[model samples]
Target: MRIVFLLCSFLSLFFASELITPLPLHINYDKSKAILGKKLFFDPVLSKDNTISCAHCHNLQEGGDDGLEVSVGIDGKLGSINAPTVLNSVYNIAQFWDGRAKNLQAQAIEPIHNPVEMGIEDTKALLKKLKNNGYEKLFFEVYTDGLSLKNLVDAIAEFEKALITPNSRFDRYLKGESILSQEELSGYELFKSIGCISCHNGILLGGNFYQKVGIYEPYYADENLGRFSVTKLEEDKYYFKVPTLRNISKTAPYLHHGKVTSLKDTIQIMAYHQLGRELETLERDLIYKFLLTLDGDIPEILNEK
Candidate 1:
């Protein structure tokens, strides 16, 4: 009877809609690279002021973002877009809301040189400075050639690759752990039944593709061009890459513009604009609970400084 029950459980897992991602979980990331990356991530040498680092925006302890609606850059200038979490970003098909970057390696250099963000005009000059500084020794220990612009990017990218937050309750359930509470199970069902899975389907849970922010209604009262700004294609207008829901409970002021503060409000907006369905108060709460399950523990190193 126990063997029969196990077989039935296995079959049920196969039939579950949640386990649909094409990518398998990757283990065994490089610790030395991650350590180098972490230092570079926190070091303000990457910024113009030597005050801002990647941690300024993608703060790990604060749900991988600094909890601002829009991020403040160097000289306290506020950016127009909301900062997304750095966690589980390794799973994303592309980086940035408009899919501007092909990988973490390419994504690493943009902010360092962005006049708004880091304010560094020349990456070579920055690397020369870093090479003469303390991280140079560490880089020499880690890499054969030491701290070049390419190696700096490589270290940061390596650290980002190690930022995966695995073993969520959903992942455990997928691995046949049978651990989700009744409310969580119901919430997961509702997540699927309401077609949230249509876009949010993946290991990263929504980073796999792009979708229009408002399909049914015009979302733009103020004309934020979204993907059109990147592509200059009419079809790409208002089409932003679907953000991963991993650590969703932490990474809010939600949405692209950071207009919505509450998850309940964000859900209502998404339901109305994207789904054409009005979520009841209780249903909204349930979906929120399921989203909370996506909040896994943060990496210990991120919290230290």
Candidate 2:
């Protein structure tokens, strides 16, 4: 057992050295707020029932998601939409599938009051509850107003901004710091040639824009009107926020609906329906290898907490 453990550790270290690459260029965020945000993120007091934290939906150990088809919110009410991984969310052009929230600050306050989510009616009341706890000192130190809804959202947003996923194999190859196997490189070519990169570009990959799901294939019809809920435009029906591919390996159950499970299935679906291309078996395998490179290690603080 000891010898096996030693071998495993050695292998991990070896891989971490070669495969661990830094983030894509554009995701600029503050480190100072990230520390405070990480703590506030795990604190359940943010929820009205004092049961769920941000971690409930976006668990760090579970690739920043809770591994559910649909996340259960306050009182165990299953939310309508699948939860997206919080990892690399800082790269998202907008928040939520519907593109409802404009930034992290606006996004943070949403769950706190959602009857199905945190269930907190009042932000001030929630802050008051957490005031006497460890947050009080931290709050006072971080913000001038201290414990206000603005500060609460700001702090959480700050932490989220730091949750950027760098050091993926794709990133390493992109930086010219390392090279990918020929198959992986071939997969990247297919990915770009098939127009997958059109929307899923930039540092966060796909979060920079919104696109219609059925552009190539009919989206599985559901009552959940995506961006239409926000825009109220008839043309906006079935449109959803383009998700970032950073840590794609970890954030499974792809698409806004989470109908597809495997990365290969997703690639095939995209090619068949969206891109109007058919990928060969070797091509699909290469793409899968490239996608696998997106998985990353979690922050040490989140694990300790």
TM-score per model over all chains: 0.89, 0.86
Superposition-based RMSD of candidate 2 using all C-alpha atoms, in angstroms: 10.6
lDDT of 1 by residue, 1-305 (tens): 33553353355445547544433355466778878998899888888778889998998877888799888889988787888888878888899999899999999999898887888987777977787678789988999998888888888988888777776777777677888888888888887766677667678778888888877566883457777888899989988999988878888788988878898899888888877789999899888888887766666545533
lDDT of 2 at 260: 72
Candidate achieving the largest TM-score: 1
- Whole-model lDDT, candidate 2? 0.74
Write down the lDDT that model 1 would get.
Answer: 0.80
Residue-wise C-alpha lDDT for candidate 2, range 142-166, written one tens digit per residue: 7767667888788788778767656
Q: In angstroms, what RMSD does candidate 1 have relative to the true structure?
A: 6.8
Q: What is the C-alpha RMSD of each candidate to the true structure, in Å?
A: 6.8, 10.6
Q: Residue 24: error of model 1 in Å?
A: 7.5
